[model samples]
Target: MESISITPTIINPKRVFKKTTGEEWYNYYAGFSDDFVSEILNSFELPKDSVILDPWNGGGTTTLNCALAGYNVIGIDLNPVMNIVAKSKFCNTDDVLMALDIVKYLRVNNYPNKLNDESDFLLNWFDYNTASYIRYISFSLQNKCNTILNSKVFSLIFLALFKLVRKYIGKFIPSNPTWVKKAKNSNDKISIESTKIKIDLKNILREKLSATFVDNVSSIGKERFYCASSTKLPLKEHSVDAVITSPPYCTRIDYGIATSPELAVLLGNHPAEIDNIRRTLTGRTTIDKSFLEIESLGLTAKKMLLEIFNHQSHASVSYYYKNFAQYFIDINESLKQIKKVLKRNGYFACVVQDSHYKEIYCDLALIFTEMAEENGLSLIHRQDFMSKFVMANINSKVKKYRDKITANETVLIFQAN
Candidate 1:
């Protein structure tokens, strides 16, 4: 139970979480780094059966790494798409291979030749031919639902199709599922040959199947994931040994839009449902202003929000202020839930980035530490380092104000008492 040393160096997942093939379950954006998780876990003295809980288990980074390290884990997230990811990553090698086999067969043998989808979301992003191809795969998968049910094959199929469509077809253009702005091919400026380069679905599937094979999949720990909100985790009090997670960024990166293509395939047949789902996620704005008690936000956070609100000359300032306020409130509620489930003296570590709200710095790590302490956990350690990803994200927002952005993160560890 010695504290781990921290260097000023930033933690990068690409460098830290290296494994054999088949580790890339989902091409998710902004997941916790496996190396960061492993570094923290190694510093803790724990039993082999210690239960690790990651309530915001995006892409299953924490669960997958810890399971490989032989700890049992319970990961929870409100997004069903991410739930599918964590669950699929932990599936046994046989089941994963089985899923790949079934999906491959269905995709190739029973391909539907026509598009039946009238969803504007799908239509706007995909050309007619691409749409038809995607629809055929969806139809074939739906027809084989019984065979794919309770297995990871459905998720694998969805993920492979997601990559094929997003990388090859969608061209990484839409900011969110809402696609409020009309969609245009960014590649139009390039050349017809580059944009129209043929993509072989069968070849892509074959490559995906090969990449999805896990050799030491049997060593993965006993794990479970829930598509439940973190504010109301479905676990008993004092049940978990440790909590390792990184909550969604305060930056306005829409999770709904980030995974819209996957959702379109998995949940949405209509384009309107995409916006409906976006509104339910924690980070989005709230139109109702009646419930905001800005005064209740801690002094540190309240100062940051007021600065953003006061500095803004636009009518939309209130909207941004309210969204920022709601984000902190939501985080506080989640902290209470984490405290409730963690055993006394158990550790809770979060990787959080400090972000800007209209050019005013929001010391998110300090705010989260204060909030966690208010909810019955005490801060044990704090480490800071610069992250290029954070700087790039902030710069995207800062370019509007013509301000320079510097980004750094803090690793806050707290003990439940």
Candidate 2:
């Protein structure tokens, strides 16, 4: 395949959806399309034995895609729930039937009436009946002493079912609500019958997992997954052949808080554990105030921070940029580590977007590219992709808030010199 030029015009988010199957699962913003990954790998001319690394592997998209492309892959994420998900998707298995059987056993035998008193968040978010049922299933699976070959299968089923239940029953609000006050007054209603919702959810899980497993068995190559911070990867120096990842944006999306309920249900963690989980995450709301000192170290960062502060309130801008700045510094450090491990002339591909903070556009991709160049990497290609999904609806006041930020994202490619 001819290598494409890196430019902002190459990315068409609308086209991404148009090219996909249009399935509900494919529509998920957090999940990457398999076709997109394949295209990226082909463009890179990845060797069959190339070792690929995805530092922020969300939903196992990059890891699984690498496996399908005949490359050895290592995926790292801070979320243990995602670790389970990635493992289930990448690990090869001979007998999916056994996995389904294990799920059946769990479904029949597990039913806890009382949760640990420590789970206040779970109790708050989930009605007792729903909580107990989910707990029973999770407990049964957890107590299974044997490392059942179908553990991943069960986990996928649980995750898929959890999503379905949330969607149908309106168990929680969407992760980002630009205008919470207006949303409350809208005509939308939280509605879904519990029993019907559960059955529908279970059926979808069984179907999706069954199809996914069948596809996985037919694919080639081996893949590995890890649960750790990307800034501190466990791999040895010069071990990987390439790097491909899409780091989180600086848009103050509290991923941990947004997904807290889901993680709690998946891990069966008590409510008390939720706070610990959120606190451990890296992003806008999670970071402490002391990180602002980095401004003295990087001129570009100082300029970006100043711009952010100029448009948004100082407190809000600081709240968003504190962690993002750290994330950049961490990425710079990670790239140094990446340079050590990656083979000479190895490729580094990143899909990133310029995000806004109250209309103040922060060119994070450009900033990171400059940082990477300073750390001994050379920028080879930069492409801008259009993100069609409006961050905030036009008529809403949130759009006015976001217009102060950025409107689009970009993808950049770098190479080890």
Candidate 3:
């Protein structure tokens, strides 16, 4: 049969609701449609119990859909919180009731404790009483690990608090655009009110519990999620039948910092661990400027990096150069690991978006194809779909490096050579 090129018509974003209970729990910043994943997986003529792999499972869309389709799936992500979130979606009805019971217990017995020493991120983003309540909740959840709900159930509560804090605080001040915590001006400090802080945490917690405990939800198959880097996949050779995932963008959107508030709630005591995880993510903004060594880059990626390095005239030119070089290098390393795990003739599909640095367009799909070919994978098909407005500052009037950047989502499929 002749090779076919899948088009945008094959994808329908509204199909995310097809698995309402599974998809509803976790909505990370970078996520794709569940239908998109289903279409790609269905294209291949694989057995029902094939083992599928998702290296960069941002919001667990690939893993969730695969489980619902009755395939065994392994999802790996560097984000600790997301690892639990992905695994939690596969929880049974008994697990949901257990999570609800835990939430109820915490609500009635736990009292807001005075937070004497909290992280600055928490202090700035949450008001005093809000921070205290979060501390209280975290304290209470930690104490009841043996009986009520396992660590995973505790994560559900932590994630709920994480969502509620951001929801209410966002009403006060918009999230900082950059990764670093910039010095807030005087007027920004005055906007947070104590009454706003007192927004019923119990009510929000119960609502989250209700949403998680759907009427009739069942796990399709055995699914596992691991907190591991994509560059170093810990799987046996030729083990997985198919690999499907969406790698992070090279546009310097700090995945760690974007989810830092959640991390703050989860790992408030472990500041060093938080920083280490941030530094280890694929396209983190804080690159080591002194370390200028570029990894194994394909011809297309090298050309793009050099062009961006030469053309970039922004204030943070050095940082941009490092970020571009590091992203491709990391991706190339990850592709090699992916090839090691995929069986002969196994399919590899990636959902990526094109990005812009200054005026230069980073054709991520083309660059990724080059990397895949270098690592002995043959391109089978490419599909382009109109993505939502997730680009950086596309609508803003500011003339930043990432402003006015736009592109469609491209799915590049490859088969093992």
Query: In model 3, which regions exceed 4 Å deviation?
Result: 1-9, 12-23, 107-120, 146-152, 172-219, 289-295, 315-317, 388-390, 395-405
TM-score of 1: 0.83
The better candidate by TM-score, 2 or 3, is 3
Worst 10-residue lDDT window for candidate 3 reads 1-10
Scanning candidate 2 in windows of ten residues, the lowest lDDT window is 177-186
lDDT of 3 by residue, 36-123 (tens): 8888788875788799999998768888888788899999999877776776665555555566676665543247563547553465
Write one digit per residue (lDDT tens) for candidate 1, span 368-412: 977888888988778787776452442354677645566666778
lDDT: which is higher, 1 or 2?
1
What is the lDDT of every predicted structure here?
Answer: 0.68, 0.60, 0.70
Candidate 2's residue-wise lDDT over 132-172, tens digit each?
A: 66666566666663332235555555565556645543434
